[model samples]
Target: MTPDATLAARVTVDLDALAANWRALDELSGGTASAVVKADAYGLGAARVAPALARAGARRFFVALPDEGAALRAVLGPGPEICILGGFAPADIAVFRDHALVPVLNSAAQARAWFAAMPGAPAGLQVDSGMNRLGMEADELAGLLPLPPSVGFVMSHLACADEPEHPLNARQLGDFRALTDGLGLPRSLAATGGILLGRAFRFDFTRPGVGIYGGAPFAESRPVVTLEVPVIQLRDVAPGEAVGYGATWTADRPARIATIAAGYADGILRAAGAGGLAAFHAGRRLPGAGRVSMDLITLDVTGCAEIGPGTMVEILGPSQGVDQLAAAAGTIGYEILTSLGSRYSRRYTGG
Candidate 1:
């Protein structure tokens, strides 16, 4: 049966818009722009997203784990380059070699392990720069001197690229340059935010992640995901009557409330119901009315005349993008996108 025929919420992905976002970022990159498809392309399903990106001219892809790289390799075949950003693990060496995955060595021990097991295998280097969360420290690099020919590139991540004027941006840039300069290896220090920070940060290649998935830091990005939830029922409440689990919202006058078939379990953050969140019907904003429960949400749809049982309410689309929804939930777009649950009947269009 078709998705709309059921009560299931739906997530529609626009591959054309996704590819367009990549092309736009690539144009600004001034170098190759690799796609980061980790976390299943930010929970949108990497199997489909990666191939669409490949067709859009993304020759390199990045994932967060060795298993993700293996899964991507199966879907992408053998042509595109897949790099694992989680660094090397002795346990993952077989997976890496079998899938031809490149590990971005993040420390001296990881570097030593990788070089010893697969001496001439393709690999990349991730220097800590200023994001101490991962990558090799400046002092650690001294021990791996004269990186092998297989070490194709050197890269670092920016902690403040989104905040362009932050002092850490310049400091990290200088640190990366000092660490990798004169080594003559290709360098990459930018992701979506750094790409927008301008050409200097776009060394060798820029890895654009959330921006390509229709998130912020790339304001011009095309809307790529549309989420619609079915309204299971609608009820009228007299003035002063409360709605939902906690009785947190009450009708000041007579009201029509819509109970949709989705909630936090479906990745709709409960905090959004605190206030200022709304679902759309025929372009009209139907503000949320009460505490978002585990499996449902109540919307104050009193004035939306066309809304009724089975009416699909838009949660994410042209009327409200991912970032806007995230703001209402007191979180970031990355969390919203990645938190998208598996219950939705997903549809893909326009590759």
Candidate 2:
């Protein structure tokens, strides 16, 4: 068998689609579009994804930590801007300065620390607006009026931009405007969802994260990932035979069972088994037969022709995207994508 065909599972990342998604979002932004490579580009291997994005004309990237930014700098080799969304501490200043990372100061304290340690350095200001998760509150921002010349831009996150019609979207927008309307600084208030909210939220630049990775809130984005696992064994189960832990599934009649070489350990959420998840073979849907184990899952593959050990089964692919898989796992697509295990043989195509 070919090297890839022999693998128990594989994750194929279409860098071409990823770059296209960024271009699409960038076009929609009406301004500059920055890539969010945080969490390893939402666990799709930022080392590869960031370069593909940069090649597609992306000039800025965002990460959640200083280390992530520093690593990306090494891979990108300078020129592009790497901003840290998680802010920074005194200890992190060295990493930021050495790597030329811009910190999105989220609080008065963080702002003070950045200015005190690295005066005249480029930094971004993050106002909370209404998320109450990060960034300086309106009152807090008011106290720091007349921001330093070193502050490169002002930004805020949308709490309900994905919902579009969510009242909080307008509320947050109004709050963001109230805090930054006359700042005369380059401002950003949108990510993927916020970009979809229309030109009103695009501001000066937009950061596109999950949407660039083929997740929701960017419904038109091209799918970027496909996952498949090999069926390692096949067996016939008699009626009344129970399968897997807790005897959760029982055969009602003669059934052909295929044991695939993947499970929760492979980032297939255990909850998916109970969520009526299924595997696909040659366009045929095969319902899962039992609970997902640490390294294997049994699927009812009866009536399928030409099936046996070494046959590959589709888990997340053309028939089932990440959002659909996330629904089956009772989680969000971000969790599904970021949770993917390292065991899969990852293949990249069309950068």
Candidate 3:
């Protein structure tokens, strides 16, 4: 059955897990935690997620661009600091100031333009440690930056913190410390992974995006998002019965298959069917059958006794990590979370 045209299907979000995850990350970071709620809270309904975090006592938040920061301001209300990870565009200057959002200054040009556009606005400076993505050049900061009180904190991105023990962890941490110490700016260097790298990298505030929402960049945190889809149709197929659009799987024996109303268009990649499994009925394992189509994906249910339509099957959480799904899809938890389709009916558990 398709989700109602008027009512969205419920996408269960566990706010308790989210709160627990946040507190865990906070403790890991020596009780300093900020949150990154970009890309619609990684496609898990940011409107619901952001307020939940605020209620959990999160005083700081981050977003990728100005629009997201503005939208978050609307939901999260005033009093919390919102940092835009992406550097500012001239167009966002007025909006950023009016909304009380802090821009993460990346390049010398952004710094010059932002100051020119909105002089004396509160801003954060991001130094390029090793990501080489967004942030100021090391050499450029010494000459261009005035060390003004308008700058809130000096920040850097860690490239290899995800591996925990990677040598780059120490290198980035040491570089970030050596650069920002005694600059009189509040400092932050850890993402989810940095928290796991011991307390040395945990500076004044730690911004965690994925761990708060149950995507494990660090295994220490529990899941916060659970995808459970209802089994729509069930049918018996004879041996050699090719299933789904591409006829990718041929039944070796009489097989029962069930189709779920989720597909590539909803962010479950076409490749998830490549030897991936789904869970149902108190955790019965079933193989992903054939190809994942635009609005539907099939699962082999031959061994599932007493299974039929209207039963819910879990796509992730407890049974499988999103990391495994990302591996199957040739992507990452960040991409999978951000790319989740908007069609699901959603529900949030706990306050």
Give the whole-model CA lDDT for all candidates, comma-separated.
0.93, 0.92, 0.81
Q: What digit string (tens of lDDT, one per residue) describes model 2 on residues 149-226? A: 999999999998889889999999899999898889999999999999999999999999999999997999899998
Give residue 11's lDDT in candidate 1 (0 to 100).
99
Question: What TM-scores do the predictions have?
Answer: 0.98, 0.97, 0.94
Candidate 1 residues 1-351, lDDT tens each? 234456899999999999999999999996499999999999999999999999999999999999999999999999899999999999988999999999999999999999999999999999989888999887899889978899999999999888999999999999999999998898999999999998889999999999998899899999999999999888999999999888999899999989999999988999999947899988888899998898899999887777777889999999999999999999999999999999999999999
Model 1 clash number? 0
Ten-residue region with minimum lDDT total, candidate 2: 1-10
Mind giving the per-residue lDDT tens digits that candidate 3 earns over 1-351?
Answer: 335322223467888888889888887877789888988888888798888888888998999989899999999888999989997898777779889999999888888888788778888899888777877767878877566678888899899877877888888877777767678888988889887777788888899888887776777668777787777789999998899887888999999998877788888888777746455557667778898888888888887876667777778777776787788887788887887777887788997
Clashes of 3: 9
Q: lDDT for model 3, on a 0 to 1 scale?
A: 0.81
Ranking by lDDT: 1, 2, 3
Give Cα distance to truth, residue 107, candidate 1, Å.
0.1
Candidate 2 vs candidate 3, TM-score winner: 2
